[model samples]
Target chain A: MIKLKANGRERVWFYAFLSPWIIGFLAFTIVPMLTSVYYSFYKIHVFNMNVVEPTFVGFKNFKYIFEDRLFLKSIGNTFTYAIIRVPVGIIVSLLVAVLLNRKMPGTKLFRTLIYLPAMIPIVGSTIVWRQLFSNDFSLLNFLIGNIGLGPVKWSSYDNAMGSVLLMSIWCGIGPSMIILLAALQNVPVSQMEAAELDGANAVQKFFHIVVPMLSPTLFYLLITGIIGALQAYAEMSLLQMPGDSTTTMTMVVVQNMYRMDGYGIGYSSAMSWFIFFVVGLITVVFFRVTNKFVYYEG
Target chain B: MLKTENKQKRALPLVRTKKTRKLIGDIVCFAVALILSCILIIPFLWMLICSVQPESSLIFMNPPVWPDPIRLVNYKEVFFEIEMPLLFKNTMIIVVSNMVIGIAASISVAYAFARNRTREKNIFFSVLLATMMLPWVVTLVPQYIIYNKINWLGTMLPLIAPSIGGSAFFIFMFRQFLMAIPKDLDEAALIDGCGRLGILIRILLPQCMPIIATMIIFSFNGSWSDYVGPSIYLTDPDQYTLSIGLSKYLVANSVTPWHRVMAGCVLFSLPMIVVIFTCQKAFTRGIVASGLKV
Candidate 1:
């Protein structure tokens, strides 16, 4: 009888402790999530007195999204950005991590310097990058001009994505580099010594042993990077890069929802759902494929 | 003795040659590190230089590399011309409230997950993890509509209120940190007539100082830098955060003063840079722990 009462009390405590998250989950997350899905299927109208009546429109919002040229263009831009940014970002960060991992004088200072950019606010950093890439008075162009190259219009449609990618890589490389550096430190020194004894060159040792050991961290970074790239918004908006070519899906969605004419909430909700679906699919596919390659040290 | 001396001399030369090669490698490493560091540092340096220079210098065909008689006038303009003080106050209000509510809720829930063992707990934990994977954009429009309907459209409540529910990422991070604490501590507290909340408050929270600090820094930084959230909800000039306020410099007019914009950027980034430098070890540990283990 005493044991039963104690067990009952424990359950009560567990529930009590979990109450906040449970409430939050229900109100903010679960309800909002369901509402988004529902909104996606409806034509939501806000009356002058701020009354919201969502009428069931079935697949109309989805169909409109499909037909929307801006939406399609944003999707194309987003994909292109992700494809170029993710792999390149991973490689650059990994290389920097390796360089910083070296046991040398001033390595700590160098790491700190490298990570300073990541600490800057995204909006602030984007502003800085915009100035750096400005065509009229670009420091980058000035330096290149000295080398006899013509000035590049970095914020132009042709170079806008590239400039954004460059800034993203600079800001992003820090955390990934830090994580990879930690993973590199965790790699067994004895294994490297043994490889050296067996006459393995530095490149061979790095690729064959170190890379395998660090694959888990690498995989983690890759997944997160993809998700982050897909959600790219602040930089694009802050940079104010010209034309439809620079508009990401998130940017387009935000623009559509916040339009002064009326609430495009339903359509925007539909687009967000589509993005969520794509992200989910990509995550599923990545995990399925990478499970074969990601090494978890025993 | 002579033959032994000869062998020693021969071995010494090989050792010296190997040391030379190692020295060369170190030099190369140093060079690369220096170059990369310069690449990382130059942008901020450039911003600093540009912020102090006259607007005319920026417009010149060959812009002056160094500011002539560095002026503090642009920073003065940023403060006097712009609503910087109001923006700072608004940001602080949002950041402080969010941190307090967020940390309290996350600690409670994470403690429950860490200390309790039940089938439902396991299921809920998985649900929480799944929620982390769901993009914020998925919740963006719906949440906005809900907030708008509730008449929170022009208020900071939209930013501050949701954080009261606890963030999934922070909760997950706290849960991981709490799990690493030995269960024996919680059991001991329980035996001493402490309830679960008592154990969380008396036992776990004190040990979670590092994570708490990390959360504070992250929450502050996030709220400070958040442009999209503020831009979406706050339309009033008086209610704008630093981010939205600073962004105005870009879209203001054709003759936007780059110097003042750079000045705003410097001031905007200063706090975060200071925080990073001061609590760098904690910052790094938090990042590595959250990134790798999660």
Candidate 2:
């Protein structure tokens, strides 16, 4: 035991302070995580599990997930959404943050308003979006209609995923923008002035200086954004109707475990593990690929 | 000639005055931000407009921003659809319990990290942080099984009690804030016969009010906005938090009442807006701190 020479009881106080978290982590997080792994390899029926013993069916649940058309479609939808949503979120939020960073008169109030979407509950914002996107009375279509385009069927199979993406971007970017704006403050003002002195235009200064300086923040947003994107649940889950094509991976796991006639505990556990692995993989890949671009102010 | 040459060198190669250029910049920035912000705020304005519009206007066509004789009958319907007082009570229970346990334990865990130097603690802290990245879906079913096994499925305990373990994100934030405070402050308190808990409470906590306030707001809003947790555990309508209640209100029937749903949404978002307006500074500070690596 690599024990420090603390007065013998100091360690006692330390552990005592840690006990609540320790207890919680064990029972709630760590135990469940371990048990989920165990459950994934076993054919554990949902309601009759206490009555019926679970059989050890190694890799069977994994086999089911890969073969299940719904699972395949849902995972595909989630990644497709992430690929588009993550970049759009980053770019749009960065643009807004730059606009706010312009520090014009009353920009602060506008910043608050811009962030208001994030402050509102997702369900609330989504319900409002549902109304706005309702084909019968779509405000979006009305606005587009003025531009000589016809009404968009926002909830159609073709547009359902896009509708959710539109709402997600609106809500998601506010926080990212705030974070990026904070990072913007740290992007050396002296460098910007020098760039200006070098006769660099706005676009040149942004790409050359601001983007590089903000890469760390951008990278952080990317990883978290992808993580969040995979779990795009509430909006998609709420607005989901018959023939709605936006069932995300999180929704798949949720329904598989919770809904009636679900694949039961074993299958959902495998799916959860699959999600865990993917999240871990994406995070690892990001760290590996984007590390060189991230400038740490040493 | 030399002075003019120096002035020309410092000045921009432009015909316009600096003041005019700055004014132009300000207008351009504001115009762009204003247009985009207004675009973003449309949903909110739509939310507000729809909440007050009569059901007649909402059903047939897009509700106008100002309905002819604005009505608040939908807010009244939210009253009958769900017990607002009881709903708030149920939510407050989750919020208060989680905050009390989550904050205190987070502080204790953070205190240990900040003050207690141990080789194991560093690894422990890293493990703790790794948990934050562990998505809730991984634990959802097993935790649900555990809760069900213990017959806690229909109660708020599932939502509230897990937080007894200090949340990894908050603990990490608190630990960072604590580490920045000089070691000598707590050491001086120790010399003055203060106990560990006393030193933590009297010396450390007051200095961390901004972070603490931030946690309060975050935890409060988190509970308020939590749809998944409430939907999963609290199966009974009587026990439903505002999120579940509002969702049910929206989707309870085939013909969704747009006005009442918006009203419920407005009600759902009210406390959050108030919390933000009150603690906006603290939240921003916490977020800025959060983005930095510890």
DockQ of each: 0.31, 0.32
Q: Per-residue alpha-carbon lDDT of model 2 for B1-294, expressed as tens digits?
A: 978955764685564445566777899888888888888887787777777877634534653356656878889988777778888888988988998889888989988877885557877875774575555665666677788889998988899889888887678656655654546667877888899999888777765665676577668777888988998889887888888877786677688777777777788878876774565443232332332324
Winning model by TM-score: 2
lDDT of 1 by residue, A1-298 (tens): 9988877877887898888888888777887788777877877764542428878889998888778777677787878888988999889988888887776787767776787676655545664666677766677787667789968988776788777788778777765676566556546566687897898987898899878877766776676677677767756765666655434345343534433234666777777777776766776688579857966432
lDDT (Cα, tens digit) per residue for candidate 2, span A221-261: 77667667776666675555335453443444453443233
Scored against the native two-chain complex, candidate 1 gets a DockQ of: 0.31
Interface RMSD of 2: 5.5
Q: How do the residues B140-161 of candidate 1 rate in per-residue lDDT, one tens digit apiece?
A: 6567778877899989998888
Best by lDDT: 2
TM-score of each: 0.74, 0.75
Q: What is the TM-score of chain A alone in each candidate?
A: 0.83, 0.81
